[model samples]
Target: MTVESPAGPSTGTSTGRRWHVLGAWLLADALALTGTRLAAVALPWLALTTTGSPTAAGVVAFAELAPLVVAKVLSGPAIDHLGARRVAVGCDAASASTVAAIPALHHLDALSFPALLVLVAATGALRGPADAARHSLVPVLAESTRQPMERVTGLASTVERTSSLVGAALAAGLVALVGAADALAVNAAGLALAAVVLGLGARSVGRGVPADDDPHSYLVRLRAGWQFLRRDPVILALTVMIAFTNLLDVAFTAVLLPVWAVETGSGVGAVGLLLAVMAATSVVGSLVAAAWADRMPRFAVYVVAFVVCGLPRFAVLAWSDVTSAPVVVMAVAGLASGFLNPVVGAVFFERIPRHLVGRVGAMSTAVAWGLMPFGGLVGSALLALLDLRAALLVAGVLYLVTTLAPVVDRRFRAMDRVPVEVS
Candidate 1:
């Protein structure tokens, strides 16, 4: 299906060539995400098992996510200045070096807790910019390939979910076999490979910087992006809603679920199993969203997806003693979760100018992810204060209420309007 390019003009690349370019970007993204996913599981597990303290695990998680959010907020100008492909390559290289050090130090018996935190922090800082760089390239890729933004977004989401499924399974096996610290080496390798892929494949893609050059101060440029986001009510609404949801999600994934697994005498392998099923179903959801998103009302699909994605998983985990029930609940949630990004992506790409995409996209995502660093710590503390069921119940109820805001509030219906192009 043909759709207007977010950039207002297509690159005129042949259909086959466009698909090839899109394919390369997708594969590189999958590899990069796989590496991060591996590190995600290994890092927290290392902290939890080695220190035997949930608080310590939360601290490690905070170290990573906090730096990442800061980096993402500040990296917009740098992406525009250095170019997306270049930034992606540099960031991945830096991540690989930092992540590899964890195992290297451990093998030398030189890995102190503080040193590990420093290394993980470095990785997080690199990850934020790298992720921004990759996301900034999405609109460009879709325009170049002449694909609909919704379908491209859906495809990208699918690739991410698929990689997470594979990456989680791989991480679980590696952790079980070679131990968590050693599993980090796989992350390092994946990052290195992703760097190589982008360097080679996206060499000819134009840098994301705008045509009108400005010598404005960094803060001024940053403000310009912020101003644009503030002016757009839809962007602001989505950002607020997502920030809340992401906070709950991180809390659940990073701490609560794992803690529950331990309490139930279910191994890390079971944790992996639950996550894998969710990711796999998410892939299906993304594909379906891609095929039919155009036919559905964006607002309706978005709200319904969030309704399914939220509440039930938490409720099931909290109340159900049966393992299979929670798994099924998560699977259903994942399926709904898959449709969300495509709608958001379509709107996001359509509204922002092609030139400002790097700066604006970075700022936007940083805002959405702003609260995530505290999620792990808060989740751990809640487990300490409240029983598991009560904590989950609180999360579930809060999620249901907050996630429904977009549906209940009249302002969110603006999401259905055609995007007004920013100058």
Candidate 2:
């Protein structure tokens, strides 16, 4: 099947090629996410193993994610102007190189704490734009294939989560077999392969903004994206709600859970097990959403998903002595979270015009990721200031408040309304 290019369909474009296009993009996305998950594991492992300090680990985490948020915020206009496909390839290549550097430096005995921080930060910075570029291609692929946008969105989310599961499993084995630095090398190779797959399979997407299409200053165009987000009630509500929840989730996954694993004698292996299980269950949820989510009221499904996905695991950890209970809670929570990404993706596409997808999407991502960089630091600090039970309790309560905000806010009710596709 020939896929249509963003500029226009070529003579070779055919409907039969739709599956091929979708498959290519999906493979690329999954691979990219897999590499990201590996890096997530490997980076922290490196810090913890080398420094033997949770504070150092938190600093490394902060260095990686903080630059990522800032870079994502700034990448919108550039993504639009440069073209999504181009940006995707460039970012992936850069990521591969940067990731490869870590293992190399370690092997050479030249890797310092500060240098590791800088390298991880570089990888994070590239990741934000690459993700935006990849996500921005979804609607284009859907339109060309004449597929339901929501289906594609659900499938994409599922693929990403599945990759996370696979990646986590890979990280654990690689770290155990060789070392954390070697696992990072594996991440680099995955990213490079992803870049190749995307380059070959999805050539027809991402036309990019022409030079003369919008001659406005970069900041002016950025303001335009911000304004669009501010005016859209449904998107606005979703953004705020997700942002708060993301921070809590990050804290749980990056700090609280790992600490729990160690404190309970469950070890790093248990942490990997929990993460993999949660991601696998999340994939199950995404599949269910793909099959039936469109038939339900999106807001209702979304709100319920939030309720299940948030706060419960923290509470479980705080109250239960048996590790098995937290696993069950996490699995159930993951199952509930499956419907979330598709709902958000569909709503976003329905409301934001294609021409503005890059910018608006970037702004939306920036907001969602805003607090994530500090999650590890905060979680560590909370642990230091309070006992494990108290820290978990505080996090659980905060999560509860954030998750409930949407149910109470009138603006979020707009999600119940039918979505219309923007031109």
Backbone clash tally for model 2? 3
Q: What is the lDDT of residue 254 in candidate 1?
A: 81
Q: What are the models' TM-scores? A: 0.95, 0.95
lDDT of each: 0.84, 0.82
Question: Which residue ranges in model 2 land beyond 4 Å of their true spot?
Answer: 1-7, 10-12, 207-209, 320-322, 419-423
Q: Choose the strongest candidate by lDDT.
A: 1
What lDDT score goes with residue 303 in model 1? Answer: 93
Q: Which ten residues in a row have the lowest lDDT in candidate 1?
A: 1-10
lDDT for 322 in candidate 2 is: 59
lDDT of 2 by residue, 126-179 (tens): 999999888887777778777666788999989988988898888778887888
Candidate 1 lDDT at 102 equals 93
